[model samples]
Target: MELRRRYHAKAQPGQRLPDDVWTTDALGVLSSGSKRDRVNAELFRAIAAYRQVVAKFKMGDMAGNALHRIGVIYTEYLKDPDKGFQAYQELLAHYPGTKEAVNALYKVGAYYLEKKQFAQAVKSYRQFVYNYPNDKRVQDGMLAVARCHMETKAYDKALDAYQSYLSKHPDGKHAAFAKAQVAWIRTYHY
Candidate 1:
């Protein structure tokens, strides 16, 4: 109740919250409160803060961050995967080529994977790889491609993806795991 009051007070119409207060308030509840209380606080406060920023600036780096945080809160704390997906999609649609968009794309792919929508997961990950080939996530995205194939029981495609990943990123972080997967597939499927 008090938190709601404070949030409303700080986020009154036509009155933007101070940057410091927004940041502090968003973080404060997480630090000292119970886990459930902290998540509830984060969800409400982050939304208010984000709305205030967008209302004031229209769009900016901080607004992008706030949008990403809302997606995370929906997914991580609220356990609302659909809302999380919506928030992430909104970020990508609005922010387009920003770093936050890249992250949102990856997260969208992950959500698809979690939902067992392998085709959509592959598409999203491929989009990320195509758009940000130089980004560190490319390796992870490639690994996810192979994982999606494996999960969908496309052993041949999974093998192909693993081989491609091995060829391209021999020293990549997932190399050991990829190698193990290859050996497992050969032993079990062949």
Candidate 2:
């Protein structure tokens, strides 16, 4: 109750809770001045309250930002790819037009690639390329799509994607790399 009061006091009238106070260090504060059991209880209560506030918000850039943060924490701090994937997936689903969506798409593709899930990586990169065709990262996404097919032993598909990218972006940042890959793929076929 006291924590809730403090949280509400800091919140602007009709505004959502500020993002800063949810930091792990601040969350640690709930343990101070309490016994082990009491501290755990208070800490969990605070976490639950914060989650409730987070849930009340609409899906968009803000949600994407939160999901990205969660993803990073899970991926880097917790060393939990499954949880991280869920966060990335949520960001992609909720904010497909936001910068976070682009990043989420890249992360999802990379995650699948690392897991050797080449088909899933190809699907993700394809979606990214289609959605953000004009983005500077489009070239990289194109390359990723080709790489996914290559990793999956689909040499023809890899060659086709790379050729398409070269046709559209002859002078792209990845152009030389794509051409090299095309030559490499041709050697396998011939």
Candidate 3:
């Protein structure tokens, strides 16, 4: 790719480029051309370059950003949820304190939910709620747990999850939806 050529063109024997430099090069490649094939090729190139940055600077802020970007590229552009989940898992493992880890944690649950893996989804969502109780996503994470139970026709478990959500976040954004689901479950399902 032209982008890779440009980066290597500027490479010296013993020089360390700033993190922004690599990211900027990646962004240039991503927005360089309009051709789908070209863009796809550049995306792969960008992923590789960013991955190198992560490997070289394990604890840098850019590493976390690059990791999150890799996950997004895998999930959204390549349409490989498994690879995306793996990238997210790696981000969580390596940078558990980063903001990207919080996002990755929730996305793991979403991936499981998309696959109809309710038990795994519940586990991921519960982990998210437990680790990030004060996070803005905690309410949605709790609601997702109940939703997973309801989808699997586990009325009692769903009720319990919804009740737990309400007790913890009585004024949560999803309070009304949780209440409605609870009432419906009690009336018709249970």
Candidate 4:
């Protein structure tokens, strides 16, 4: 309750957020207490301020960036995966065209992957590739889908994904990894 009060008090609507707060991991260079508290205070202000920017000023990109930051803040800094995941999802829905969407997709997939939700991870990874075909990370997304299938011990799916990855990205960055994984899967699973 106190934290909620603090957040509301600091996060005044339409307040102008400072630029430095974004890069400030430690407001007082204090890791646990001041970092979290100060970062939350300033970031709450930023979130409020940017929300107004999106609503009134009609700045989609800026607001999308802000949403991405909020997701990161909740996920990494605040240790709240649920809120962080929600924030990321919000960004993807509201700002699908923004560059932040690409990274948000990756984070969302990562959240599911870290949770060992292999099916969800596969879906997210495939979505990442399907949605952002032009992105440099597209290969990473494709490889991730295979990795998710591999982790689930779906050797046939993994084999197909790895082969597809190798076909699509022969001599690409992860080619060796794909080849190695395919070899291992074939030798052991077959």
Best by TM-score: 3
Q: How displaced is residue 38 in candidate 3, in Å?
A: 1.4
- TM-scores for the candidates: 0.73, 0.69, 0.78, 0.74
CA-lDDT, candidates in order: 0.84, 0.76, 0.88, 0.81
Q: For candidate 2, list the clashing residue pairs, or say none.
A: none
Runs in model 1 with CA error above 4 Å? 1-35, 186-190
After superposing candidate 2 on the true structure, give the runs of residues whose Cα lies further than 4 Å from its correct spot.
1-53, 59-61
How many clashes (backbone N, Cα, C below 3 Å) per candidate? 0, 0, 0, 0
Q: How well does candidate 1 score on lDDT at residue 70?
A: 81
Best first by lDDT, ranked: 3, 1, 4, 2
Weakest 10 consecutive residues of candidate 3 by summed lDDT: 22-31
Question: Between the candidate structures 3 and 4, which one is better when assessed by lDDT?
Answer: 3
The predicted structure with the larger TM-score, 2 or 4, is 4
Give the clashing pairs for model 4.
Answer: none
The candidate that wins on lDDT is 3
Tens-digit lDDT track for model 4 on 50-152? 6676676445477788778878877877788888898789888888888998999989999998899989988888989888888898888888889889788
Candidate 1 residue lDDT tens string, 147-174: 9999899998899889889998999999
